[model samples]
Target: MSKLLEVKDLAIYFDTYQAEVQAVRGVSFELDEKETLAIVGESGSGKSVTAQSLMRLTPMPPGKFAGGSILFNGEDLTKKSESQMESIRGKDISMIFQDPMTSLNPTMTIGKQIAEGLIKHQNMSKKEAHNRGVELLKLVGIPNPEKRINQYPHEYSGGMRQRAMIAIALACNPKVLIADEPTTALDVTIQAQILDLMRDLQQKTGTAIILITHDLGVVANAASRVAVMYGGKIVETGNVDEIFYNPKHPYTWGLLSSMPKINNGEEELQAIPGSPPDLADPPKGCPFVARCPYAMKLCENHMPEYTNLSDTQKTACWLLDERAPEVEPPESAIVGGAKVHG
Candidate 1:
């Protein structure tokens, strides 16, 4: 697969009365054609902000990119003018948010919302756009799409609304789709259905996907590659198998141990104990140093550079600091795929 979107050293910071908040710091990644990339992290880890910055959506006054370039299809999105970005935002790169109700217009008919994008980007006639709208609705698994199209946002259930959002996002046949917590509000069954629909659509349309989600389970099934974030930086990144089987970052280990296992039951879910560091005045060494179970003197005083484990595996952790004290692997990480810290 070819590269469709590439982000280089992107940083989004906010100026506040209290202090500056570095929501996204020096993050970089690429989305290949027909491939799904999962950005997994706890809340406030800057995953969503990193997604928004690609569209230049961050508020200028408070949210500013200190440094970086958002390269989309060989063109620099950061260099584009506001008017130019407007044309690219939805047509070339679409997004589906967590909540569909907030995204959809209450007054407009659902059909009109989907058709509007078709008419604008594809330059379709009213009749053509309307027909396409119904087709899109059906494509996302909505039954009786033709009749449902005329209904307002309130008429549909939560899952249906989300499907509508997907239909609208896919109306223009974008090269890439950024879905930020797309399954958040729905129940397990609906979430599975929606995820299946997305996977099917991806296979059919070959749309590069950036799946911004916190769920490790979702990452396991949905992504080809995963980038795990903590305190605005991607501390661990690799192919899904490498991430799940050979996780190098202590943060990744913490996340894996925290995942609820059927046999182990609920109470055994081991969450990372400490809160994320304050981005305004984040730790100088490693952001996860406080929460890391194996933090050392070196981990607290100096930031560790990213260590290359393989072509598809990379992690930033002082635990990987060859000079640091050797430590044993966590007992909870005993599994077929999982490997001891290198």
Candidate 2:
């Protein structure tokens, strides 16, 4: 697939009274046409911020674009005006935010909400848009969409509301979809349904997806590629199989180790020790240095460059250095496509 979006050395910072939050520090990634790329990490790892920066969606009074470019089909979106971005937003790169209740307007009917994008971007008439809105609702697996379209957001169940949000996002047939923790508030079953619905829709529409979430299970199920983030930067990126089967970075190993497993009955889940660093005064070296049990002197003093493991796999860790001590990720952590070893 061709590259649909490329974010290069993107940086975002928030100027607050007490400190400057380096929310996104030179983060970069790519999304290919009709592919799903999952950005997985703990909260505050800059996953949402990085995705939001793609649309210039972050509030700017305090938040500023520190550096870098968001290129969509070779066009630098950073240079586009808010007006220009508005034109691109729903039509080309729509987003499904984490919460639907807050994202949808309480005052408007779900049909009207979905219709708004169609009317604005597609230039459809009110009646036409309304009819299309019902179709969108149906497309996202909403039953009785025609009747439900006239109902308010409060009238819908949580899962239904999320479906409506997806309906609105897909209303404009966006080429790229950014789903920022779309399943965060749903129950397990509903999350599965939503994810399944998204995959089904993607198959039908050929929309490339940027799925930002902390759930590795979701990443395993939904993504073609994975980008692991830590302390406001991408620590590792690779195709799903390589990431799960041959993860290189210690941070990636820690993340994989921490996931809850089904077959390991009564086994306590492993959690990575220590918290992510405060970005305001982040470390001069590797941000994972403080928490890494495998930390070495070089890890504490200098950041490792991203080493190419394969054409599609890359990792940033001193452990990959030719002279570094030979170490292997715990066999238990290899749980994506490969067998889990004892």
**Candidates' RMSD to native:** 2.6, 2.1
lDDT of 1: 0.88
Give the candidate number with the greatest lDDT.
2
Evaluated at residue 245, the lDDT of candidate 2 is 84
Evaluate all candidate structures by whole-model CA lDDT and list the values in order: 0.88, 0.91
Candidate 1 lDDT tens digits, 1-342: 678999999988999999999888889898889899999999999999998888887788788888989999899988898999989978999999988768889999999999888888889999999999888998999999889999999999999999999999999999899999999888889988889899999999989899999988788778899999999999989998888777888888888888776665545667889899999988888889998888888888787889999998889987777776777657565344433221
- Model 2, residue pairs in steric clash: none
Model 1 earns a TM-score of 0.96
For residue 260, give model 1's deviation from the true position in Å.
0.5
| Residue 95 lDDT in candidate 1 | 94
| Range of the 10 consecutive residues with the lowest summed lDDT in candidate 2 | 333-342
What is the Cα-based lDDT of residue 285 in candidate 1? 86
Per-candidate TM equals 0.96, 0.97
Checking candidate 1 for backbone clashes, the offending pairs are none
Q: What lDDT is obtained when candidate 2 is compared to the true structure?
A: 0.91
